[model samples]
Target: MKRGLMIASALALCTAGCGGGASGTAAAAPVPAPTPAPAPSPSPTPTPTPIASYTPAAAAIPTAGIALPLGKCVNMGNHLEAPNEGDWGRAIAEDDFTIIKAAGFTSIRLPVRFSGHAAMAAPFTIDAAFMTRVRHVVDLATAAGLNVIIDMHNYDELMAAPDANAVRFAGLWKQIAATFAAAPATVWFELINEPNTNLTNAKLPAIIAPALAEIRATNPTRPVIIGGEGWSGIGSLATLPMPADPNVVPTFHYYDPFAFTHQGATWVTPTPPLGRVFGGAADIAEIDRNLQTVRDYIARTGRVPFVGEYGANDVAGVPVSERINYYGTITAAYASVGVQSCAWAYTNTFRLRDGDHWIPGMLAAIHTTTTLR
Candidate 1:
């Protein structure tokens, strides 16, 4: 017998043969089994729209003069880059600018997380209050005679889904450019920071051109910085694409001999091993070779390079003296080549300052440029 027929017969027999209560009410008709619903069809994936590419003009505009003012810089990190100003434990204070100026620093690279503070939909508006807050910091830095490089930092969504976010990225820049339009030339823009993942060397030019266009719409001729994929490391620069615009500056970060510079850095996967102290003849030679690679790139491209970030971690396992030696070596090497550099940070990881004062000898280690003093 069929399974359904067998079940029906078994229920019928029980209903007929089983005795009812003394009231003799017939057993209620056996409830029917419910039919299962059909499975849902899967939604189709949306195809990504292709982004337009840029071609540099026959004669590239010179960027060496554009990149000179950012001497002896330092990143004011772990502040506006956080989801909230103080979420990373350091907020930009008014006096912070005064202190930075007193330390002989000529520029401050202010990193802001624009995506986190902006709407993700059409028009992609950055919050007005947050924009104002950023302006306040910029005004404070410039007033103290510090050149401010307002960098678009930590846009995780764009790195993950470039095609989906490109328009929004451009939208955010449209607002940012207009906001700083009237500001002096000392205020600069770094289009995006540490691009990686879906933002490949092949895709970066398409991504940068639109944002650069937006900036030029209002602030033409202002210097804008751009870095390559793979977290802006030296290897990344090998294929970095530049838009035809003359004022764009090429940037890269260095933490070479990574095992030593990033020792005990909890954030890096498998964490670089602890106790990898720096300062050997081989170590010194490696720094020289890397800076030479930068010089070679500059010679080939006429775009003066900026060391946007370079520092060794201040960790429990490494002595302060060794860290200072590494800083002195790296900064002096870049200065020798006339490539301006900004250390990793002021008061966070790889910090030059502690509480209110700079770590002992840390300021002098990086103050290798006579122009900076």
Candidate 2:
């Protein structure tokens, strides 16, 4: 399940800075006062202009300049996103990158729950030790020639109390952006994992605007990913506020026909009914309809889409054959629409592995180029 940190209010904050002033007694400037000007009227205090809120417009959406290979990508989930390394039952090993690359994946999305390793107070400093560990993992992926996407994951606190946590949320990105300022272009930043709760379509722009500005200040041209409201669901794609930056890539998650993908998944509220299956003609048509929603959005906005997360839970009790078919069909659908994607996980629940070995059928379903190993 996605986790979050409870952030404190920042209402009492104050800013400090430098100022200069000058004063003089009666006789100080006698030379220049020959034609003494009438008593200078007090300069009217300048009225402060209220900052204009950002309104996303279609004309403002720039062409995406950065190209992320849309080919096979996988999520290194349940690792860094956990409370600690190995706590989620899978500690990422350096060799994992090698395996990912060798298996034909061109990128890996690293979901990190930064709130767990950050200060709860102002400045919200991320734990240095945690950052070091993240850097090491990033280095591993980059060295293996796989593009790495670092994302803020499971920040439920920010979602629930967006107004109060705005400062801390921006602070978190400010630190993250600065920390990865010098990272290679292959290293990408995803603003946040999934924006839900009070951070809905209507309120998303206010929260993300400052965060995007914070990131742009440091890594100006880096490829940053932004998702829509409602857990980044495809239905919300049209309503997502697109930033003016050309390097930004819009993303959405796909677990369409939720009953089929999340069947028997306990984490999902009112748990999805089990025994749901995929691969029939009707199922394929329904999947196509969902993919078309994304395709239409991309065409309308001219912003490339990235399917950030997609997968079926292994324990959903659907037959392995149906799961394989689902993965293959969805992967093809994504390819058809020219959208990039990363499967749900490398290990843990909804994983592609059973213990240390690759689940042959699952691997083949994801990477069509390779056979079962």
TM-score of each: 0.81, 0.79
> lDDT tens string, model 1, 160-188?
77888899999999999999999988999
Q: How does candidate 1 fare on TM-score?
A: 0.81
Please identify model 1 stretches exceeding 4 Å from their true place.
1-65, 368-373
Any runs in candidate 2 off by more than 4 Å, and if so which? 1-67, 367-373
* Clashes by residue pair, model 1: none
**Tens digits of lDDT, candidate 2, 8-85:** 111111000000001000000001111223332222233322221211112212244444554678888678876677
Clash count per candidate? 0, 0
Q: Give the TM-score comparing model 2 with the true structure, all chains together.
A: 0.79
Ten contiguous residues with the weakest lDDT in model 1: 15-24
Q: Pick the TM-score winner.
A: 1
- In model 2, residue pairs whose N, Cα or C atoms come closer than 3 Å (at least 3 residues apart or on different chains), thus clashing, are none
lDDT of 1: 0.69
